[model samples]
Target: MTDASLAARAVALDLVREVLRKSVPLDDAFDAHPDLGALEPRDRGFVRLLVSTVLRRLGQIDALIEGSLAKPGLPKAVVHDVLRLGTAQLVFLGTPAHAAVDTSVELAAARGAAPYKGLINAVLRRLSREGAELAKAQDAGRLNAPDWLWLAWRQAYGTARARGIVEAHLTEAPLDVTVKENPAAWAAPLEATPLPTGTLRRPAGGAITELPGFAEGAWWVQDLAASLPAKLMGDVRGKRVYDLCAAPGGKTAQLCAMGADVVAVDRSARRLERVKENLARLHLTAELLAADVATWDAGAPADAILLDAPCTATGAIRRHPDVQRLKQPDDVAKLARAQGRLLAHAVDLLKPGGTLVYCTCSIQPEEGEAQIDRLITRDDRVERVPVTPDELDGLAELINERGEVRSLPGMLADRGGIDGFFVARLRRLP
Candidate 1:
């Protein structure tokens, strides 16, 4: 194998280990790995694709590896990761067979799994030949998601629809961006399509940094589902808007674009810097606060508040495939408790007759519908504002009988799907 190719494989193996073994998020791992950024841009993209492919199709790849194994128990996690890497390339990515096998064996040797190098090479070679047929025979949906998540989805969405969610997650998500100005004008120049909700959907191309409007700050990378909460605020013109727990501030930028006197608050100073950078790029302004929203004083109540509370982020699994691997049931419970705290604090920061837009990139009702139910039932001052069908560009199916917006991955399957999100627009009584 070429030295350069081996280096690329090494980077991919490191990322896979960081995510699966160390429980680090893919994006965080990417950011922390100096080798990843130091590599040529093309190689960086390749490594990213390799790592993401392994994560997204891990279930199927593991099944293939297990089928090739003679013993019953699983290999060591590192060895298993190497096997997953090779199988991902062979079965899913259609990588050249020789390159896949050689690189994986090299990875095994370099990563202290040298004793199992033969096993890695043999299994991957067998997989390259027979993996497709094996994958076809297995349940793709069940194999692609973790057991707890699969059961949760089945109970919540039923059998067929839950399967569809898993299926959608296995596919790569397209790049959806929210533009600062006219969507139609940008769509034509960028070779993108305008979604019903006015977000621009572009074909997957090179690095997003190199995209046309990116440097100019004309738009920001945001999932179509994630952008909906701010849009639900409707005409924030001159309104005092607080974006709680805002980081990597896509929603905060949306609020600023609408001429809101926005105060964006979050606990991480580093992440808040990203918000400031994005706002500057777009020629927008917001009052940035690096403090916890649950305890941060807004001083005076705001006209509208967007609590994009942090949660398990299950709905975003399509985009962040590692979520299923890293986030546990306990993590969900912990996040739910935090969301409850943030929701209450958000209510305290709103004016009477003002709106509090509560949203989470989580399909779990505990973080979405159930949270709202708990809030309204316990606090009589809170009541559902009920999002109208027209506000969502006729996607009324997203709004439940109680009038909250629950967007699932399967909702826009034909258009490359969207993140799972639950948005509730609540109003405080006068």
Candidate 2:
């Protein structure tokens, strides 16, 4: 193999180690990898595909590795990561057996773990021969997700629905966008299909900025489920709306296009800069603030608040497979407490009789339903607005028993599945 190609593989190995050992998110590690930018574009793309494929199919890959192994545990993290990536290349990515084995051996030697070079070669070669049959024997959905999270989903949704979610995560997400103007007008131009909940879906490939309507800023990328919360506001034109914790601002742009006087607030100034840049691209204007919404005073309550609180974000597991890999039960417990606080503070930031919509890209009920239920129990000053079937274009399956929109990844199985999102709308008492 060429030195550059081998170096690219080294970087991929390091990134996998970064996630498995350090628990750093896969994307964060990939973006922050210092040597990644120096590689050839083809190598860069290879590295990206390698790392994400390893993460996405980690459960199945690990199973294949363990089954090939004489025993259960790997001796070193570098060994584990190297074998995992090699197994991914051989079993799932259709990499040539020789290239996967040779490079994996080289990677282990370069990492100062030369002792296990033979093991990697033996395992990867074995995988090349028997990997396909071994892979077929494993339960992919259960293997890919953390046990605690799988159990949580199974308990929250029944076994059948949970299986659907895990299997959905096995496939990558499609390119979904929120159009600023007449949705139908842009649909044919973009060659996109309009989703039941209103976002447009197209084959997810190529640079988004180079797309047809992009130059004119007619649409911005947003998941179908992520776009749902903003629409729950119901014609925010001319209303004062606050998009709390809004960065990488898809919802903020939606509010601006809806003609709402939008103030998008997030804790990080640097993150908010991206929001400002997006709004400029779309020719949409909004008030951008870098402040913690939990305590930052808006001085006056908002006409409506869209609190997209931080959570475990298991809903976007397909796009961010690291979420299920790196995150744990403690992470969920910690984030749930924070979401609860944000929900209460967001309620306080609303004008009496004003609207507040809370959402999270999380399948966890603690971050979604439980937060609302607690708010309604303790804070009698607010009442459920109960999103109706018509509100979401007659997709009643997306609604929960309490009338909140509990969109699971399993919904829309024929078309690519949507992200798992939980949205609830409420009105403050006068």
Candidate 3:
């Protein structure tokens, strides 16, 4: 193996190990490592691909590695990291079979697993020969999901839909950007179309920041589904709008761009700084507050509020593959409780006849529909103002019976896929 390839493989191992062992996000891990900065741009790109591919297909990779191992109780951390690098090369990358296998063996030997080198070699060789059969027998594509997550999906979406969501996440996500202005001008260079809500959909490749509209802030990266809740607020022109939990403020930016008097509020000082940076780039303005929404009163009730409450973010699995590895079923229950509390608090801050848009990136019913159900049931002042068909022109498929919008990747495959999102708009009684 060449020194460059070896170094890249080592970085891949470190990334995978950190994600698995420490649950650090892949992007954060990459950004924190100075060694990764030394690699050439192409090698850096390769490292990201290798790590992301492994994360997206960890289930299949683990299955293959486990099949090769002799003992059931062998430590998972030792084998899983090595297999992640190997599987990324063999399955996703299409690296030459010999080079992929040999480099991995060298990686194992260098890590002082000299005794396991022959085992690694023999297993990978066998996998190279019959990996397809093993994948078929194990149904690697579907069962690759963690057991808890697989069961939860099965419970939530049923067998067929759960299978579809998992399969779609295996592929890399496309780069979708929300245009601040002049979608047509921006669309020309990106070779993308202005989808509903003025989002530009680009094919998933190339340097993100170097893309034409990115530097000038003509558009900012936001998923088509994620862009919906702010749109559902319906023309905030002169109204004061509070975006609770508005860190890294995509929704807050959208609100301000639409001419709303916006106060972007969140608890994290660090995250709020990101929101400030984004506002500066877009040449937009908002009142930034680093205070907890649950306890911090926003002076007086605003004309509108957008509470993008924190949840499991299951809908974003394709974009952030780390979610599959780090989040568990119990995490959903915990988040749902938090969402319930935040929703109640946000509703209290709503003025009579005002609009409050409640949203979550989670696909879990508890976090999305169920929480809304609980809200309207208890609050006589609140009523569901269903999002009509005309209002959701390009997103008809995602609208539920109750008028809530649920964006699933499967719903928008033709116009370009969108992230999983659930949005509910409610109007306080006059």
Most TM-score-accurate candidate: 1
Compose the digit string of candidate 2's lDDT tens values, residues 149-210: 88999999999999999999888788999999888888888889988767889987666777
Per-residue CA lDDT of model 3 for 29-62, tens digit only, reads: 9988778988988899999888888888888877
> Which residue pairs clash within candidate 1?
none
What lDDT would candidate 2 get against the real structure? 0.90
Arranged by lDDT, best first: 2, 1, 3
Model 1: per-residue Cα lDDT over 1-430, one tens digit each: 8887888888998999899889999999988886776677877888989999989988888878888998865568888888888998999889999999999998888988899998888898898899888888988778989999888889988998788889889887899999998878899877888999999998765778878888888999999988899998978899999999999899999999999999999999999998899899999999999998889887899999999999999999888899988988888889999999999989999999899999999988889988999999889988899899999996787888999989888887778788899999999999
Which one is best on lDDT? 2
Q: Give the CA lDDT, 0 to 100, for residue 307 in model 3.
A: 95
Give the lowest summed-lDDT range of ten residues in model 1: 72-81
1 against 3, candidate with superior lDDT: 1
RMSD each, Å: 1.2, 1.5, 1.9
